[model samples]
Target: MDSLFDVLETNNKAMMSIAITRKGQPLYSRAIGYSWYGPVKTQANTKTKYRIGSISKVFTAVMIFQLIEEGKLQLTTPLSKYYPTVPNAARITIAQMLNHSSGIHSFTADSGYTSWLTQKVTPATLLSKMMPAEFEPGTQHKYSNSNFVLLGYIIEKLEKKPYAATLKNRITGKIGLKDTYYGGKIVAANNEAYSYNWQGNWAPDTETDMSIPGGAGALVSTPADLDKFMEALFAGKLVSRASLTQMKTVEKGFGMNLFVFPFKGHTAYGHDGGIDGFRSQAAYFPADSIAIAYTANGVNTNLNNILIGVLSIVFNTPYTVPDFKTTLYKTEELDKYLGVYASTQIPLKITITKKDVVLVAQATGQSAFDLDAVAKHQFKFDPAGIEMVFDPINSQMTLKQAGREFLFTKEK
Candidate 1:
């Protein structure tokens, strides 16, 4: 797969560690980039670990089902049994939270999330952030990390142990996922990869405090371990087939934490994870008995673009690799677009500024992100699927993302 770099239009500009499995056996594995970037770079390998982020929700869901099997809980159990103070807690069921229909506001999606991302949080802190239910429980579906965080707490309450210990005693130990566990501060000496985002070079990304993510995210693993977890979970070694079916159930693209991943005529069930600058994925195709897992500590372009390229080759389908071409504009050339811009369609305001040769953009209370210049007056932040076309003459910027467009007029 060395040629994958060529097709990826990479000149060591991307980082990846991937493993493929079929019929519960390893089929392929590859690692690229450094585990620790410094004076003496430490090259990453298959054993190198990464924070799997929200993929930990799949593990959380599996444990929740296991508790149900043991008669310790039920899908219809009211969340108020554990946290009665939460708004509409009595009306929210375990199943609703599992399927993301609980209406619990996502704490991480809050505008102030970035400010405290690196600090530990208390139950009271997280509880305070759980805004009033956006809708009646089970009336609609919306993705919320608050749901999983509460579920994680419930797991601790039922199992009489911390989430990490329960994870080991229940799943990883039974399944032999040696490299998977609750994570702490990253230690390069332990082969934990530090994540980065590229501007003109790889800039170290801030590490979100582990305590804050809780069961919604906080787990470190390798691609191989993730592949193993998916294989075992799908093979009924982790949960019963009935429970697996429950996890695979979806509405509006989210399922208990499992998501619908459609490529061609094949449907794969799995989850994608991201934290700080790290990104990871694990997808299983039951029909083909194939499991694919990948982790990236650094990516210079749209990661889905990279994943599709890898999948097309694996699935034996013809694929077209895009040409990676961009024109560089001097920092001074971007001065015309620097200002606070507000949109009529969205509540948030976007501020644009340039650092060195990179054009950076920040939204309302969100973190600032660097945008790459793809063409004159056109820029993109591929990581977030955001593109901007600046009409400097009109003092306006058209923002496009996920097939939606909004016109933003710069503040005078």
Candidate 2:
């Protein structure tokens, strides 16, 4: 798709790599953009591995399902069975953890986690710092990286092996993913893509120390290796058909460490990962027998739109990227809508400023989104596929995106 490349190039994307396969046969592959930015200017290649953020959750989930099939563990097993030191562990079940319904507060959401990570805290010590359950176990669905961290711990305890070794022996090794590994001090040669944030400059990729965020987000892999891993996983090379079915089933938005995107009349299953500077997505459409793996070294590029564009080509669907057209407005027109808007359900606050729009969601710090005018009273997030419709009649605005909607009321 030349048009796809044009869009990316026009945006000056720092790095973009993609691998596409159908029924285990490679159909298309490409890599573009500099892996490192400087006077040296090293170009990225197919072999350049990337820190795949939360996509590592899918691998951890597969390993756990394999253990379940081997009778070494059960999904209903209580957390206390393995780690009694955790508060209220007796009341939390493995199934709850898998679906992120455990109600345990995410260590990553803790304000001090970043500081602790910088100091390189051990896994046990990280767990010890977590507070009690945010709510009773299984009360509702909430994503927490700590759940998967504990899952990694359980895998290590039950298998009597290091998490990395077990992952290699069971998943990566069995599937022959030559370039995939749990990242550590010794990164592979020609191995990983250095990551960059959108600070108007490029920098090296950063991640939480493996000892702290291990199972949740601690894997490095190439796009080719990711495609291979998904192929083997769905081919029953890693687990039984019944176990595979369970893993793909949507228990919640989060299940077995994977997020299910049941959208556009097809069930596309995968996970999207974001660390400090790397973002990755690996998705498979079982009905179409299509799998796509995309990894980028730059943050804030909104790779989701690119994936949707590629999916349109693959699925023959009509897809159009929303045009973020800006309309000239007098300062007086902007003042009427400038106020704080709040939503109780998600507990989000939106603050409109003269230059940009910002959202503060529960447990997520404030993130600024550039707003573009589409109509007299409507704005769209150019980077995030979100639309904000202002209803002056009711003095409210609705945030619509990704098949979900939330209403916000202006503060008096």
Candidate 3:
């Protein structure tokens, strides 16, 4: 396991940390890259904290179940009991929200999300941003940060304490996760890494306000602590076995706050999170009594690729490290790729742009993402499994994603 990371650091400059355990015993642990890349660089280590994004939902779900065990709430509890003014609140249940069947439109998906990402939002203001339900309650499974955000508020309401206070009193303190808590501004002095994308350098990524994400995606933790949380939660130190079982109940690819991952015919239950450029994943395999966690603060490659590589190394399967090579282009060379592209089969128009030498692509009304060059006129965003081959002569592009290809023409 250690040799794989050694190879990755030698070839790839991406910054990340890892923790692996078996039956609650540490098997391996490692950290690489800088938590703060400033005048004096702060190297990230096992104790460096990162915003674990939606993994915070797992914590929120556990607290909700704790309330349920105490007879304070139920799976069928109506959102109307707490916030009746929310759209369709009267019809949504706690279970529906837990399993992402509430149809609550994710506020983060709104066009204006990036506009105010770094600013603190009041509860009422944030509530108004949740657009109307996308479907009837329990009709579909769609992950929505709004669901867990509301659930977080509901937890505070029931506990009669602030979310942070309740978190300490209930979860982190119990598990001895001193590094995990509701997040704030990225404080490098505190060993919290500022997230970054690979743009010529490790360019800082946008930071969302902690107040807005609530229980949905606002918690800072280290990889080691994350592994501990998973171990303790599964060992019945956090919630009752019945509650844990309920939380693990899978429906339509989502559990209460958990997601299912299958590896080599073995089932692993865990969650992944992303906010800013930071990405994290934590998984627990009951069958093998194993738990693994990784927190990435800088990424130049596909996050999925890293997960697969790490898992392969852990399972002792044959593995190969990426060369992390890319062709560099002058700022002027990207001009031909700049245009609005449209496909006959899809409604969204893709706009290609460039900053300095970094190629970028953005779909209609969506945030722009940097694209890395693989070859001449060829680019890919591996995180989304997206690749685009461009024809500067024909004014066309072939977009491929999820194994489907579509030809697009540059719009006049």
Candidate 4:
């Protein structure tokens, strides 16, 4: 078994903390890198807290289950029963919110939401800004921060207490997560990790008003505390067996609070969290009695890739980091597939270039992924998880990944 600190020192430059356990016994708990990168050097430890970001959704979901146990709410209950002010509140249900089937526009999509996050705003005001529905309620799955924000409001309406107070009373306090908090007006005085963003070459500390994120991404917690929370959640400390089943039930791509990931004949349940400058992932394998939690203070780096790497190292599984080495292709080879290929129903565009493959994804922004050939006609961009399959017979191409594929036609 490799020391967690040794792995961190070798793989990551940003501050990182990891905790792993099996059958309720702690196997690894360690931290690496500086707590703050500055003139005054500060090192991190097991107690150092990082912004857990959307992992807060798991906490929010647990609270909803608590309310369900108390007979105050039902999964099938329509949102209009609580907030009649919402435009299509009657059409959306509590379960839809949990499973992210609600078509409400994610507050993160709002152009002005960023500015509002810098200044504190009440939950009601934030909800008010999201009055119009992006799509019909419960029509399809679309991850939205507004769903959790409304959930926070629903908790307050039913409990007759503030969201933060209710969270501490029902979830954090009961689970013995001392370091976790909703993190706006109330924050831990010590051992809190400052969030940083890379501006040019230097890191700058950044903060988001917790009130704005609410149940979506406001919680701050440590790796050990998160492990405890997951244990309690699955061990039936938080909800009954039936309620836990509902939480884990896969509706579309999301379960209750956690997203389901299918890997190598095993089911892994966990949530990944991300804010402006922080990224985190926590996963638990029930049958194997194994759990993994990773946290980093940088955004651009895909912690999922790091998680895969750590899992491979810990379990001694055969895993290779995707090859990111770019290969230069002749202009003639690029011209074979170079054209404006698009899907009318889905928003996707692909352009092949001599130097790179350009993907203009309307939803995820635009980026150029360097193509590396695995074979004469088969090429892929490892980092982007995209593959271009060419048809020699017809001279066409197919772009595939993430369960969605688009075909590109040659243009004259």
Clashing residue pairs, backbone N/CA/C < 3 A, model 1: none
RMSD to the true structure for each prediction, in A, is: 3.1, 4.7, 2.9, 5.6
Query: Comparing candidate 2 with candidate 4, which one achieves the higher lDDT?
Result: 2
Between prediction 2 and prediction 3, the one with superior TM-score is 3
Model 2 RMSD in angstroms = 4.7
Ordered by TM-score, highest first, the candidates read 3, 1, 2, 4
lDDT of 2 by residue, 219-313 (tens): 98877788888777777888888887777767646656656765578777788887767788888777878788988887444566777788887
Instruction: Write the residue-wise lDDT of candidate 1 on 166-209 in tens digits.
Output: 99999899889999999998999889999987766777888999
Please report, as a residue range, the 10-residue window in candidate 3 with the lowest summed lDDT: 4-13
- Segments of candidate 1 deviating more than 4 angstroms: 6-13, 328-379, 386-400, 404-412
Question: In model 3, which runs have C-alpha deviations exceeding 4 angstroms?
Answer: 1-13, 327-342, 345-378, 390-397, 408-412
User: Sorted by lDDT, highest first, which candidate order results?
Assistant: 3, 1, 2, 4
Q: lDDT for each of the candidates?
A: 0.88, 0.76, 0.89, 0.72
Highest-TM-score candidate = 3
Q: What are the per-residue Cα lDDT tens digits for candidate 4 across 16-128?
A: 78888877789887777655666875777888888888988888998998899899899899998988777688888999999888787687788766666667787678767
- Among all windows of 10 consecutive residues in model 4, the one with the lowest summed lDDT is 355-364
TM-score of each model, in listed order: 0.87, 0.80, 0.89, 0.77
Q: Candidate 2 at residue 193, lDDT?
A: 66
